[model samples]
Target: MTMEFGPDDQIDYDGPVTPYRQLAEILRARIARGDWAPNRAIPSEARLVQEYGPARTTVRRAIKVLVEEGVLFVVPQRGTFVAERSSEDR
Candidate 1:
């Protein structure tokens, strides 16, 4: 499947990219496009699962990837937020 997401909300279940990876890419793009501002929460894991139809583990994995890449940070019970603005985003 030669699929490429183009700033869209739908996830291609039959595409080559795994659901978790696709979700990660989608979120990174969203952040870059300023859909959610720095230090602001994006969406809850349950919300993501409902929106993207992925498993909780998949959503968590995608979140983990972003956290590792410094695009997002978790605040215990509060939830996940976009990373603080940084020169790296420049």
Candidate 2:
């Protein structure tokens, strides 16, 4: 928990989607597969930046989309967490 992304966040950037959107999709799939449990902390902005090579705003946009889509929840002083059983994801 050094507040860094490292190699794990690095992405190949495939397809027509923006890097942030692609990152969102990647996180979404992981959540759907139980890679991240509900209420668990998702990756941080610094990590995402290093991994996706995108601006903070772009990453925020992608995350915002997920929040709007009901795939994530933000807890004060904590962090973003995967929503359990989001209907939008189904």
Q: Which candidate number would show the highest lDDT if scored against the true structure?
A: 1
Q: Which pairs clash (backbone N, Cα, C closer than 3 Å) in model 1?
A: none
Per-residue C-alpha lDDT of model 1 across residues 1-90, encoded as one tens digit per residue: 544554466777887788888899889888888899998998999999998899999999999999999999999989999997688668
For candidate 2, write residues 1-90 as lDDT tens digits. 112222234444664556666667767766766778887878887777776687888788888988998889888888888887746546
Please give the lDDT score for candidate 2. 0.72
Q: Each prediction's TM-score against the native? A: 0.88, 0.71
Listed per candidate, the RMSD to the true structure in angstroms reads 2.1, 7.6
